[model samples]
Structure formats: C-alpha cells, structure tokens
Target: MGGRDVATASIWDAAHRRTTVGLLTLVTLVAFEAMAVGTAMPRAVAELDGVAWYAWTFSAFLVTSVVGMVVGGEVGDRRPPGPGVLAGVVVFAAGLVVAGLAQHMAVLVLGRAVQGLGAGVVIVLLYVVAGQAYDSRLRPSLFGAFAAGWVLPALLGPLAAGLLTTHVGWRAVFLGLVPLVAAGLVLLLTGAPGGTPPADAAPWRSRAGWALLAGAGIAALQYAAQRLDLAAAGIAVLGAAALAAGLRRLLPRGTVRARRGIPAVVASRGLLAGAFFGMDALLPFVLTEQHGWSAATAGLPLTAGAVGWVVAAQLQGRRPDVPRQRVLRLGALVLTVGVAATATVAVPALGGWPAYLTWGLAGVGMGLGMPSVGVLLLDQSPEAERGANSAALQISDATASAICVGLSGVLVAGAADAGGPLWPAVLAAVAVLTVPALLTARVAGRTVAPAADPSCATNLGR
Candidate 1:
C-alpha cells in the first residue's frame, strides 16, 4: 500500500503496529520516569541532606542533556538509530542503579546528570526514528501518540512514586524502573532501521565543543537566577552571551533571530515550552501558598491540563486538512488567552478552581502547538538533516525551559523577600512569555521549500 493509504488505514494496521507500539512504549517509559522522579525528588534530597544542592538535581540533568542531544543527533545522522538508542538506555539504566544505591546527595546528583545525558540522547534518537520509520501522512498521528503517552504517566506516576516511596522506599522508584527501560530498549531496537552509514559524517567534535560551552553557560545562568544582586546580574549577562554564542554554533543559522521557516519552528518550540512549563512549575506552589489549597488539590490543574493536551493533540492528528501554520497560530492564541486567564487566580475574588479550567485551556494550547511544531519540523527537514534539525528543536525547548523556570524562581523568591504576593510576579513572568509566542505565530506562518524527496508529501501549501 502507498504511505498515505497505510496512514489512512490505521496506526494499528499490521504494517505500522510494531513501530507505533515501540515508539509509544518508549515515550511512556520516559514520561513515567520523569513524573515519578520529580515527585520523589523532595524526599530523596531530604534523606541525602542536600537541600543546598536541590536545584542542581534538575539543573545537572538539563545541562548535560544538551550535550547528549547534540551528540545523539550527530550519531543518528551518521549511523543507525538503534545503537544510539540502546546506548542511551544502558546509560540511563546505569544511572538509575547508581542513584538507587547512592549514599550521598553528590552521588545522586551525578547519577541524575548521567540520566539526563541518556534522556537527551534517547529523545533525539527517537525523533530521528520517527522521521525515518514513518511517512509524512502518519507523522501527525505518531506525534499525537507521543503526547498521549504522557497522559497515563501524568495521572499515575506521582501516585505510584508516592506509594513506593512511602512503603518500599524512594530508592525502589529508581531501581524498579530499570526493567522497564530494558523493555523499552528492546522495542526500540526492534523497530529501528538497520545501520546504513551516511554518505558524509557530521562534524562531531566542533558541535561537541559548542554543546559543552552551551551547557556551562546554562549552568551559570541557573546559578545566577538563584541569587539577586548586581554582581549576579552582571554574571547573568555574561552567561546569556555565552549561551547565545554557543547556540549560534549549534543551531541552524538565524535561529536566534526567529527567522522564518525552520528558525521560527525552533523559536516557537522554545517559547511554547518556556511559557507553559515555567507556568506549570509554579502553579502547584502558587495554589498551596497563595490560596491555601492542599497539595493534591493544587495538582488537579496539572492533571486537567494533561487531559486537555491529549484531547487537542488527537484532534489535530485527526484533522490533517487544517493548515499546520493555522494550527500553530490558533494554538498560540489559545495558549496566550489561557495563560492570561490563569493569571486571574492571583485575584482574591476568583478563588483557585478557575485555575483548573484555565490551565486545562493552556494545556489544550500546548497540545495543539507542540505536535504541530514537530510535524512542521519533520515536514521541513530534508532526510539528511532531520537528525540535526530535530536536535535543534529539542535543544531549543530544553534551554528555553531552563531559563524561563530560573527566571520564574527569581521572581517568586524576590516576591517572597519583599513580603508581597508571589502569584502576581509569576503571572508577570507568564505574561511576558506570551509576547514571543504571539510574535512567532506569524513567523511560524512563513513557508519553507518542500522536502527534496518526491515521495514525501508537502504540507506547506496545504
């Protein structure tokens, strides 16, 4: 059957079933680990007496992951997806083992850095796998499935992690996932295409150097965000310059300026991720501290948001007739509105329940925009450049999210120090993020040259 025909048939049709299942399983495993570990981190830090290094736990992962993404993309472009993915799984599982057995917070942080590296490699390879194994027609569905994979994890990961941490110990949460990692590895390997070296190898060493510099810059910014002073501000300027310099070398040309086409797609990914995730990182805290909601009640908004995301993703997947740019613009507008509405939770009269709804709307916006960017990225990317471009997309997201979250932390801390309301500051941060999202909406609308491959359908005009 033709690729389009196969796509119209079903994602579960015999021809596509194995890859679909494998990719979904990989996403699920990753999603579950992310949610579970985040939930258990507080206890883990307390037990290790590393409260001072608490933020590093996350920062370590974020920084190292940038290196992994760049390396994995290079590897994926020059070699088969299987080896890179398998290696990532092995590294990730080893990190889990080390973390599970750690006696000190330092060791745990080290393990987390290793885990971040593995996650970075695995995610980039997965994107390459999708680009290679699936046709354009099926790509949207595949991306939608990837988003849906997060739903079960979002619903259950925290609960399961809590239970295991309470009864079996937090260590079990790390060790127990090792087996699932192995299972995911098997599926990925089976589904991945055989090794066929590229005609020309990607320049790895230079990219690696740039990635390292970028990682260091990001680390510096993370540290600076925690401190509020003129000296820190000066240091932050240096860090930002370093980050921009490294990004220029690592990402496609004009990415820093949000140039039309691929650059815009990459820019939008960063803006969307920063606004949504930064807001997300603060929501639970906002509810508990400002509105006196219980932890579980505060978490409800996140759950609602996840559901909204899945619904919108599925909707977008089912309706390929809609122009991808239109979907992106619509999603961005929805997200801006949702975020603006969510800010109202800061008001005394609005109460907290509105957050559950507004956040869900924001989730819907993310659901619509995120997958569209993926589809657009794949659509615009030539076969030879898919890995590198995919890496750029993910790297944009990781870097932007880290910076935005850091900024939000600074805002919240400054608000607390001033004995003022914290939500307004956080809301201001969220509001500021919407500008890029809105501005990039038009940039995302710009067209790109069609893929060089004739067999691949072009959605730019459609």
Candidate 2:
C-alpha cells in the first residue's frame, strides 16, 4: 500500500491493537529493566562487597547477550518466533530471580549473564514479530511505539529503582518485575499472530560458535582489565584475538573498517553506543561516590538525560524531510559536547549538578542519531538479510558498550588505588572515550548510499 493510503490506519486500530499492546508492554518492561539496573547497581555492588568486579556486572550481561541475539536470529528464521520469545521470557525471569537472591558478586554477574541471554532473544524476536505480523506501512508506527516504550521507563525507572534500593534493597528492583514479565508473556501469546515458519531450517552452528567465542572474548577482557598481574596481558591478547575472529563472522563485511553504506551505519551504531553507554553505566557511580549523593538523588540526572532523549527523538520523528545523515551527524556532535561537559563533574569544584544538564544534552544527541541508524539499516538491507543485519546491529551495540564499560571500570579501580580525586581519572577516561563519538560524526555521511531516498529511510529498525 502507498504511504498515503496506509496513513488512515492506526497501529492501535482493531487489527493491530492487541499485538501492538503486547509488543509495547514487552518493550517497556525490557527498557525498565535496563534503566533500573544502572540506578540499583552502585548499591548492589557495595552490598555484595564485589566492588572490584563492578564492571563485570554490566560486561557479562552485554557479552552474553551476543549469544542470545545469535540464537534468537537463527530461531526466528528457522521456526516460530513465539517459542523463542517465550523461552526468552522464561530465561529472563529466571535471571531476575537469581540476581535478586544472589549472595556474592559472582552470583550477581551470573544472573546478569542470564538476563542478557533472555534480553537478546526477546529483543531480536520482537523485531521479527514486527516484520512478519504488521503491514509495511504500519511498521513505522510500530517502531515509533517501540521508541515510546522507552519513554516511561526513561522517565521513572532510575528514580523508582533508587527509591526501591534505598528503602527496600536492590533485590526488590530485580524481583519486582517478575509479575510484569508474566503479564507481557500472556499478552504476546494471546494477541500476536504466528506466521508460517520457514520451509527449511538454515544451519546456524557456525554463527553460534562465533557468537560464543565473541562472548567469551568480551568476558575475558572484562576480567583481565581488573587484574594487575602479568597473566592479565596474555588473557587480554587472547581475548582480543577471539573477539576479532568472532566479529569477522558476525558483522557485515568491512563494518569494523567502516566501509560505506550499511557497513558504516552498523559501525556508527557501535561507536555511538560505546561512547554513550560506556559513560552512562558509570554516571551513577560517579554521582554516589564522588558527590556523596544518595542513590535516589544520583539517579535524577539519568532521568534528565532520558527525558532529553525522548524529546529530541520526537522532534526528529516530526521532521521527516530532514536527511537522516545530517541528523545523525548533529546528534553525534551534541553527544560529544555532552560527554565533554559531563566529565567536568569529576572536578571537585564544579559539583555534580552540571552533569544532570550535560547528560540530558547527550541524550538528545542519542535521540536524534540512534533512531536514524536503525532506519538507515533497514532501508539499506535486503529483505532476506534484514533479520541477520538486525542482529548484527544489536551485537555491535552490546559489544561496544561492554568494551567501554570495562575500560571505565579499570580507570575507576585505578582512581581508588591512587586515593586522590576520582574525578580526574574519570575526566581522562571520558576524554579518551569521547573520540568514538567524534569518529561517528565523521563517518555519519557514509551511512547513506549516494542514490538512496531520504524519505523511505524514515521507516523501520527503530
């Protein structure tokens, strides 16, 4: 159907209402979990006495999620997406149980790994659902709904998590969501249409093996970063080699090199994620440790950032005529400024108050740029390659974020050992990490093909 013809139909119309609600519920819950974790993690780490392994909590989840994404993509292609999505829900809920009941940092990390697996499967399968069940015209709207799913979570998740952690303990943050997941699962089973499975199953063994290797590599790197011994060197080398090998198979050809078109889009996504989330995961820690703020108070800045992200994304959505590449570049620029400004919080005299505003600016950058990458990825990918590419986009995002977080963790540990000002080290790390955002801005133009339609790029993958 033409765009104008389909404009009259709403995603909330009778045909799509049930499935839409179900999908949005799942998306919101997942978003809430992600947002809540950052707020709860600082307290959780301190209580477990696993302060040394703080980065591992995030890295493990991100690294393990690569395995889940690969599996979800393979399953979605070969069989019914419902079963895989259901399995994801079960696994995710189980992880929450494990994390909530944890006694030590190791157990918490393990639970996080489990959560990663479920999150990966659920996320990829959700994309599959959108593609198979919804009309092409309705997909833009569906994706818009997906963006909307993050709104409430962004607004309230950090604050809610902080309050829970301060009053009820961090375990409550994890356990509290179990019932909501069950509700979302019921919604999906009842409302979502099950499309016909592929006639023949494609072999996924090779991809799965690579994903495992990559996950292992990421975990090893995170572990090694915390250790000061010589053995850490060998481990780091081995991990890098494995990560490189795995990425070669998992990503589109030349993605690491940032070859133009889809490859550049994929690469840009990784760089943007690495630069943004690498710091985001640490902001709460920065606030609590350096500023002497309560967990709830520390989370308010994150809330500000989320609000900015949503607002900028809404503005981007309204201006369909704006070229995506331009928006992507502009977002990168704004994000770069935000990251730089945010680093000043590490300075004792500046105070943490500025971060709330600066991080919000960074969020606006992400809002404008991140969604643009998703739209471009879909526009550029062939239909047959869409599922795989979608998985690649996710893998890229997670991999980069894990690496950045681990690097930050190392700096954090160093600052503790030095016993000087922690903010100075944080500032240096932010300076180094902000390079990726600058790089992303430089390559943003290559994300679009020379002859592509900018209007069509406004649809899908968000």
Candidate 3:
C-alpha cells in the first residue's frame, strides 16, 4: 500500500509536475469562466435588452465549439498539442476582450461564439496532450486532478460573479479572464511538447467543412426548439437530419448506433453529459424563480456537486485495479439515482435543500464515470488516432448537451405558460435523458480494447 501511495504521489514529481500543474491551471480557468458566465449572463441580457435571445447566448457557444473541436483535433493529429493550445488561448483571450467591450447583446453573443471556438480547441488539445505525454498509470490521476481543479471555481465563481455584477459590472466577468488566459498559454507552452506528427494522407479541409455543417445544423435546431409553430417543427426536423448526416461523417462510423468499443465510449459520454448538463443549466432558474432563492444561494448546489465530483474522481483514480467500464456502469447507476432524488425537490413538501444533497450525488456519479470514459478512449485509440478520437468524444458531449438543453428550455417555457411548476418539466427532460445513459452503460461494459501502451496493459488487464 505504501509503495502504491508513493507511485501515485509521483504524478507531481519533477518529471511530471510542470505539465500536470499547467493542465490543472488551464482547466481551472475554464471552469471559472463557465461558472462566472452563468451568474453574470442574466444581468448582461437585461442590460443589453436582449431577454428574447437569452437561449441563443449559450447555444451559439456550444454550436461553434464543434467547429473548434474539429479543427483542433486535426491540428493535434498532424502536429504537437502545444501549438493548438497556444492558438486556442490567444483566440479565447481575444473573444474575452470583444465580449468585455460589447454594448449590444448581438456582439456579446458573437464574442461568446469566438470564445466557444477557442475553448473547444483548448479542451481537445489538452486531451491529446494527456494521451501523448502521460503514461497510462498517470492518466487517471491526471484526469482526477483536472476534475479537482474545478472545485474552487465551482465554489466561488458564482458568488464572486454575483458580487461583481451587482456592484461593479457584468463586463468585468468577461474582461477578467483575459490575463488568466495569457498565463495559461505560457504555462502550457513551457510544459507541453513541441513536435509534429507525420502528415495525414486525408485532406483536413473536407473534415472541417463537415464540422461547419454540423455546427450550422445544431444552431438551427436550437433556434427551432424555441418556437412552437409547425414551421419551426419542420425546420427542427430538417436540422436534425443535417446534424445526423454531418455527425455520421465526423464521428467514428458506428458512434450513432453505439457500437461496441470506442463508439460505445463516445456514445456514453454524450448520454452522460446530456443528462447532467441539461439539468444543471436549469437548476439555477428553477431555484431562483420557484423557490425564491438568490442566485448565490441557488448556486450552492452546484458547488456541492463540484466537491462531490472531485471526491469521486480521486477515489476512482486511486483504484486502478477496477475496470474502467465497471466504474462507468456504477457511476451511471448512481447518477440515475441522484437525478431521481433531485426531482423530489420539485415537491413543495420537500423544499429546495434536498437539491443540494442530490445534485452532489449526481456530481459524484459524473466524477466516477466521466474521467473513466477518457481513459477508455485513450486505451482503445492508437497514438496516431488520439487527437481525432478525442475530438469525437468532445463533439458527442457538446452536441448532446446542446440539444437536450434546448429541448428542456422549450418544455420549461411551455410549462410556465400552462401555470404549473417548471421544475417538473426540467426534471422530466433530465429523467428522459438518463434512459440513454443507463442503456449505454451496459454496452460500455461489454466492449474492451487493448491498452494504448504496453506498460499500462496490466493495469487495464481486466
């Protein structure tokens, strides 16, 4: 046990310390931005008189992020992750600056789109770096640390952003991240490798074109979801078809079908993200409007969940003897239970505090399952394919979460008009999403692949 403890502690040793810290810091910055934006956005929209376009603010970011992920994946496959990370940081900072100075909501949305692109690139590159730089034994710990990095941001980002928006201005939230992005760039460049892979025979332009189509289709679908007319329904159907076609070409061939092996892993990621994030986006609104809580108070459940996520991730990382697939299955089950428990908060008799506990439970499930998916993807992919596959994993997650959130918005809006509790609609949407997650969990357990590295094979031998 002592020897094992020493081995785990070595992730922060001189040989690995720089890259680990750089990556963790990068993740922390992203987490802070995401949480802070959520807190600040309501004020920003009100100030800009863009209440009608509220949903588009988030949808724009998510849709454009697909384009960024595809481009980053191709870049990482053909070159080192360092260059892509640097480019992403620069672009992300530029977006932050644009957003900070924006006087209109349209400009703010465009700025967010740019930020999403940069974020997509940065996240994919980070995954590639993990695949290329870290040994298999260290991957779990690295992923766990990544989750842990979110802890502080999740705890403080909302309260801080609320304070800033209340006293200073919402623009400060966007502007403040610029310096952090610069620092992250320096750290990433210093720690990450600077080598290029052999060029691919396939043309990246074609893949990029498909990614654009996917993004457009997703955006259209989100727009359509906001309307209730038959015309909007027709548009949504057309958008879904386009999205499916583009994804078929972009992801692994079997991804939509959830074929065993890497495809199942990717599908599971989508299901998990859709189920969790869709509900997460609505929780604050539900708490504030229905339960009459302040934004800071509503955000407390999110903080609790972040803490739970890190704890579970740490526990999973320490137990490498367990199968990654088994962890995924167990996590999915736990998440289902948590989601179900959270729905009870909608009952007037139960009140809202139960959400703090249940959402944390949901976070624990995510911590257990989410990192394991990354490990499984790395385990299954060849070194040459890591970048592309990592992009697929992220694309799946982004697309699913976007669609589910859009649908939830429609449902909640309709419920609000019907003069009923909106929380049940949000909870129902989340509950429905869990079906795919639960089904995919079993499929994920059935598919196994050889380890990416020989040294790590024993750890994944199960």
Candidate lDDT scores, in order, read 0.82, 0.83, 0.81
**lDDT accuracy of residue 168 in candidate 1:** 89
**Top TM-score prediction, candidate number:** 1
Which parts of model 2 have CA positions greater than 4 angstroms off? 35-60, 97-113, 133-141, 158-176, 189-193, 197-206, 284-296, 346-348, 419-424, 450-462
Across residues 1-462, which tens digit of lDDT does each residue of candidate 3 receive?
Answer: 266755656568776677787888788887788778988999899899999878777777877788889988888887778878989888888888888898999999998989988988998889888887777677777888887876778788888898998999999998988887787777767876666674542455547777878887888898897776789988898889889888987898787777777888898899888878777777777777778889768878887888889899999998876778888898888887877777766776666889988899989999998988888888787766787889999999878888887877788777887998776786676677667557756666644544433435877776
lDDT of 2 by residue, 1-462 (tens): 567646666668876788888898888998899889988999999899998878878878877789888888777777777888999999999999999999999999999999999998888888777776665445544655676687678787877998999999999999999999999888877778876676655565548789989988988887788685699889989998999899999898989888888889989999999998888878888988998889778878877787887778767765555677888999999999998888877977777999889999998988888877876776676544556777888889878987898888788878878788897788878997799999999999889876575554555424
Could you give the C-alpha RMSD of every candidate to the true structure, in order shown?
2.9, 4.6, 3.6
Q: Is candidate 1 or candidate 3 better by TM-score?
A: 1
Residue-pair clash count for candidate 2: 0
Clashing residue pairs, backbone N/CA/C < 3 A, model 2: none
How far does residue 406 in candidate 1 sit from its true spot (Å)? 2.0
User: What is the TM-score of each predicted model, taking all chains together?
Assistant: 0.92, 0.83, 0.89
